[model samples]
Target: MTASRPDIRTFLCRSDNIGVLLRDPATGACAAIDVPEAGPVLAALDETGWTLTDILVTHRHADHIDGIVEVKRRTGAKVTAPAKAGSAIPAVDVAVSEGDMVRVGSLTAVVWETPGHCADHVTYWFEGPRLIFAGDTLFTLGCGRVMEAEPAVLWRSLARFEGLPDETEVYSGHDYVLSNARFARAAEPDNARLVARMEEAERAKAEGRFLVPTTLGEERATNPFVRAAEPSLARSVDLAPGTEPERVFTALRAWKNKF
Candidate 1:
């Protein structure tokens, strides 16, 4: 039997980080993707009247796990973190690795180790609902800065998402659509889809709305980082037309670092 769609609440935490609450309606099992701050997570729980049953940590980054202790203290939620991060993250009840399945009520998410920005980074893919909590691995039109690994490693991590259905909804860790849109346009100036996406991002920012939960199709169409294999992106980075995709990606990432 098909599972019922889960209820999702997306809110701002700290400055630009995103906080999400995923609740299984049938069983009311709620999970917070990451706790950037306890106050916002608590507030969202209060407003929605949903009890947090699990805290799913994406990586060991402080911005993502800073509030884990407090939120766990208050709600007694089970904390699940990357096995690779081990004790670096606080209050972890479960240490999961690649291919592990995490269940919240009837909802199931397969853990995918998508390291690039950091070695311990993981993305939770809820296949049943076609939703991905991409952490810092991917944003709307951009990807996380390569902090712990080579640019090629990040490219490989991003390649994992290309085969997903176009309608899959991606929930990333931060709100960087406007800046990513700007950089994407510079990388692919003549792309009408990118231009349209940039305009939408601008309007979203103006209205104080977030351009998150972006569909995979939208990312494929407009995200330059993911489209590094295209000859145009190679040319934007001053690489030859037939350059290797990985090299093209590296150059694009280098350019984006300064952009």
Candidate 2:
């Protein structure tokens, strides 16, 4: 029998952070990927009328876990966080590592240790639903900053997702698409797809639409950070065609830092 797909709700909190709610409709089991703040998360629960079952945290950043304590207190949700950094997060009940499975009602997510933005960062993937809660490791047109690791280390963390199905839906931690699209266009000015995507992103933001949950295929096509190894992308960024993907990736990230 096919597994049931989880319903997802995307909203903004702390200004630019993207908050996600995953619900198993069959059981009304709901989870919050990260609690940016309590008010929005609590309000979302109230709106959906689904009892919170779990809280999955990606890292130790203040914005990501600020609401965990309050949310847990209010709903008695179990908290799962990266094993390596479990001590830093408040009220963590389960410590998980790469390849571990987390169950939300009948839905299961495999954890991937993707540390680059921070040493404890991890992403959650629900294979049956083709959904990835990318956290801060990967974004629509960019990747997270290399805060606790070298550039190449971060690139390798990102490369882990390359094997996923092209149609996989990716939900990132931030709504940085508009700025990322600008840098992407500059890095590959002649790429028509990036140009068009930038235009579309502008309109979306202008209309107050949130652009989370982009497909992996779309990222592969338009995200310079994801396409670093492509010969055309390397050439656009003034790198040798045969340059190592890691090198290309590092250069692209450095450029984005300044862009």
Candidate 3:
């Protein structure tokens, strides 16, 4: 039998942060992925009438965990946070490490210790639904800034997702497509796919719709950060075609920081 699909809701919270709710329709079990603000999360739950059952945290960042206390208090939902950040986050009912399984009724998500954006960052990969909740680690057309580790470390963390199928839908924590598109265009000016994606980003922004939950295939074809191993990306950064991908990634990230 085919795996049951989830009902997903995406909304904007606290400026650029993206809030997502994943619901298992069969059981009416709903999980909020990283609460940026309790108000938006509560409002979303109210609008959908889906009772909050779980709050899956991705990292220890303030924006990601600020709403956890209030939301958990309001709904009495169990909180699942990164084991590495257990001490830092508030109201965590379960602390998970890499390879751990978290269940929201019939839906199961495997925890991946995707640190680089921060030491405690973890990605929740719901394999059955082909959905990856990569908070602060990967974004639409961009990756998060390397904060607690080197750029190569961030690249290695991103490489972990390469083994997953291209059809997998990536749900990142932020709405940064516009800025990411600008830097992506500069990183690979000659990439036709990148140009097309830029136009799409523009259209989405004009329509007042968030351009998120981008497919892994779309990210692979256009994201310069994810495409750092490509010879064309190396050449665009003034590096030799055969340069190491990690070195190429480092160069691109540096250029983006200053861009």
Candidate 4:
């Protein structure tokens, strides 16, 4: 599986939002994760010459699903969205929940309900490919804004990914690596890994490159929100030296809101 990785193309849309196209080379089947808008998605599909077979909606956010109807109208793709979010998203033909399997060509993506950014948020994990389309729940060095769940609940929701293989490629819904790196520095200014990543992110953005597809290992080591349990990060944020991980996470979220 590692030798023949799925071909993925990530493009920018709707300001800082991201649109991703994942194609299984074996089957020439492509899946689009979150249609920020129809124009860019259609353009990418046209440029790649890969027919869109599935549209995986991680949540009901307008930026994530605004192009669903148009894309589906054009490609006649099957729409798989979070269960119970059908009303919020248009043209959802199949509603899935945790543990559901979504088959696209030769790949099967397992759904994980990760409600934090919103109650309807979910993530698609392609086990064989080791790729996770983490919509709004997780980002590079940052997590989604908690709008529907308590901070602790969101923290727990994110914790579920702690068991994933380090090599798993994580594709998020936004190009927030630069801003997130800055906030992470505020949390752990002396972290060498974070500092190096910050420099890399700066260069990537300066040259107009995409700053995504970071691995789980990178996130685990340097993501302040994910490493909230570390005493060093707790102290950096002025939390009690031995504060619980969830408590530290809550404080970090509040601080980021103002950052």
Candidate 5:
């Protein structure tokens, strides 16, 4: 007898780092979000007894895609990467662009080209589950470093996410929860919500649990980079109420780059 289609199981591939695994339980077929290391990914698969079927890459950063070849060798999974990032990822079977729909078994994950952390950075959003593989583009409490692009580009990309329903779940590619909480404190010390969340993050780490899949609403409220354009935050950056949103974005990003 044959198993049903799709039915993917999502798990946190966590170590000192983090990634996400999307497994189609029916067929034991799986896909991994940005892989930080081959070891953790392999372990995740071993635990589930699944075969890696595809790699949904978001960017070209080695930390995000370095395990590609190894994972592919172990499972013979096809690879899909951003059109602009295909060259960096070995053996890409499909080069997708923004607005493209990537099918993983019976599930459809939409591609979002979000550049700032890298010119070729992209993200994937699984529709039925409302889960986002945010790569370095978005994190629980913090965002990725503005390494290869301007702060403004990132700001716009983040704004696009703001329009998503508040209940949307976010799964980022790294485990910087505690560190990001610290910066959130500096950005809004008086925000009791931020402080409370920081304590929760500490607890999750101490208990060996993942503190991710934070809601779009929670990030909108406490994420400094996304809220950097607010008048209060702009004032802290020495900007007037009338300052251009992009300028505010720049100041907040500069602060984080050094913070």
Candidate 6:
């Protein structure tokens, strides 16, 4: 890849919201993660002088994929969505699942079935860029609302993200830094890493910087849900001092829901 090559850039479309734009310099084929609002996607396409080649949808939520129709109509871009979500996304060119792979110019995305937020939600992960379009499955500091599944299912779905390299950049549907930080504190009051991350996120957002694409390493260190086994987190959740991992994990998530 050349230095002049276009890249994947995440833009803030609203307070605690994001729209990921993927720029394929080789073909000038731009693709968006979720189309919360068309304006930001159009703005990114305009700025890059590229045409949209595809719209990658994770689920059926309006916030996650309402712009599919307009975007495809305007650009004739293909829409790729989970096999079950195809109905909501008109003219789906590709229906994917856990083992499928999707292509965009020279880029390839592997699909992961992350179904707690919605049973059909599927995250798309690109190789070279090492980016994961997590949608509402995972957030910087919190997981998506467990609307269609149990906490156990969500925990498992989120855990699927654990093996990606520590440097994997997570691009989520929303910028939930502040609320997530508060939850992190309640989950792990004594976590020095969480403390620092909360303050850092506050200052960064205060300065108008986007607070997403948090690395797996950063999340492991600062995210409370992922670190539910930590002693501080167990204590914060009111679990017995030496509670088993399973019990603590359950308690921690319950605590966060209240936070």
User: What are the runs in model 1 whose C-alpha is more than 4 Å off?
Assistant: none
Provide TM-scores for the models: 0.99, 0.98, 0.99, 0.97, 0.91, 0.92
- Report lDDT per candidate: 0.94, 0.91, 0.94, 0.91, 0.80, 0.80
Which 10-residue window of candidate 2 scores lowest in summed lDDT?
Answer: 229-238
Show the lowest summed lDDT stretch of 10 residues, model 4.
Answer: 1-10
Task: Tell me the tens digit of each residue's lDDT in model 1 across 1-259.
Answer: 7789999999999999999999999999999999999999999999999999999999999999999999999999999999999889998999999999999988999999999999999999999999999999999999999999899899999999988999999999999999989999999999999999999999999999989989999999999888888889999988998889899889888888998
lDDT, candidate 4, 200-224, per-residue tens: 9999998998668889999988999
| Candidate 5 lDDT tens digits, 1-259 | 5444444343455354566788765556678886767887888788877778889888887877778888888888888999997578887899999899987776778899999889998888876767788888888888888888778888888877977888888888777889888887886788787888889899988997767778888888888777776777778778897788789878877887788
Which digits, one per residue and each the tens of the lDDT, describe model 6 over residues 137-188?
8889887877887777877888888888998888888888888999888767
Which parts of model 5 have CA positions greater than 4 angstroms off? 1-16, 25-28
- Judge candidate 2 against the unseen true structure and give its global Cα lDDT, from 0 to 1: 0.91
Clashing pairs in 3: none
Error of 6 at 5 (Å): 7.2
Model 1 TM: 0.99
TM-score of 4: 0.97
lDDT assessment of candidate 5: 0.80
Instruction: Name the regions of candidate 6 deviating beyond 4 angstroms.
Output: 1-6, 241-246
Worst window of 10 by summed lDDT in candidate 5? 2-11
- State the local distance difference test value for candidate 4: 0.91
Candidate 3 local lDDT, residue 120? 95
